[model samples]
Target: ALHLEMTGFLVVKPEGYVEEAAAGEEGTVYAEADYKTQVATNVQTQEVIDSVVVYITGRNYQDFPEVVALVEDATDQLTFAEDAKAKAEAAAGTGDWQNATLWAGQWWQYQVKAADIGLRAKTFLDEHGAVETAQ
Candidate 1:
């Protein structure tokens, strides 16, 4: 997924220098090039699908404040969830069922939170998907 998106990804900006010809008699026209932008973002999965891109495109706009906020909130929740899951896994792996139970309980709650966040993001993106454009 990232590979396909990357093919279209682009970073266009004014660059390159114009060389002086004959001491300012005429500025040499330097070479110039430009490219388009394509964005695909995703985290790899071990399951059947090897790649994926998780992002919500905005309608005729790139600076999506609402999307940013949503992402921030979700990220925070996911971070906590990841940490909890790691702790619980470590405890269980070490045969510490006593603490594992406690941490596992917290891990379960965080897992729910993360799932909810995922749902919220999906819903928002689906409702506000950008008008698809070819570059």
Candidate 2:
């Protein structure tokens, strides 16, 4: 088995009984509680191990797509903020104070949106367990 870096996240509970080993699978076939020592040669036991493996390595292993989308939204908003800043600079260069102020307001709005989106994404990831909490 590959080393699971985060043991805190994946908690396994094993409740089982000893069974006779089948032919050929005399070695440890499946042992939930004492996986390193006990040998199992039963289909039911193998299924349990398979389920545990899948549970540990399935959805919890990857980032949520919505979280990634939120980050992309934040990045796009930041890009717009930069563009707004450029427009504000150009308006100021032409001595259009009103237009410059309007552009500056737009830039601020974009910045706020970006910040909100980024924060929301982080919160979502933290709540979903994709981002590990500090021990």
Candidate 3:
């Protein structure tokens, strides 16, 4: 697994995960988390024949609520897709590999979505606000 940390952000991903970046404003940072792993396999082959992958990206610039709102919207969509996948698996029932894979694959995509990268950015800014306020 890979781990990353900054003043107010943290990310962890298993080995082999990929990261992509695009040009943006000076202070803006972007990171994409790949959550693709073996989701199902062929019973007879006993080999990992099927896998799924999707990218969840988080972007931020300093500590702005507008930026947070954009990230939140993307995260919301990612969560919706994840929940639908779970429900599909449950409804597919056991020993039904074909149906399970089919239903789950319906929600899996190689697309990138917005995600939350920091849970403590606001706190960090609050703690450091003294410098700004004092100036």
How close to the true structure is residue 135 of candidate 2, measured as C-alpha lDDT?
29
Report lDDT (CA) for all predictions. 0.47, 0.56, 0.39
Give the distance in Å from residue 72's predicted Cα in candidate 3 to where it truly belongs: 1.1
Worst 10 residues of 1 by lDDT: 33-42
Stretches of candidate 3 above 4 Å error?
1-62, 114-135
Off by over 4 Å in 1: 1-62, 131-135
Q: For residues 1-135, what per-residue lDDT tens digits would candidate 2 score against the true structure?
A: 124435565544457855678776444222222321211222233354344333423333236788667667766887897798788768767766566666666776776676666556656655778634232
Q: Residue 41's C-alpha lDDT in candidate 3?
A: 22
Model 2 pairs in collision:
none
Clashing pairs in 1: 9-38
Clashes by residue pair, model 3: none
**How high is each candidate's TM-score?**
0.46, 0.49, 0.33
On lDDT, the leading prediction is 2
TM-score of model 1 (CA atoms): 0.46
The predictions' CA RMSDs to the true structure, in order, are 23.8, 30.0, 22.3
| Residue lDDT tens for model 1, 1-135 | 567567877544447856567754643322111000000110111111111013333232244566556656656766775676677558667766555555555655654555555556556656776453344
lDDT of 3 by residue, 1-135 (tens): 123454436666669988788777664221211112224321211221111111111222235664356446545655765675675567455545454555454444311232122223333334544123211
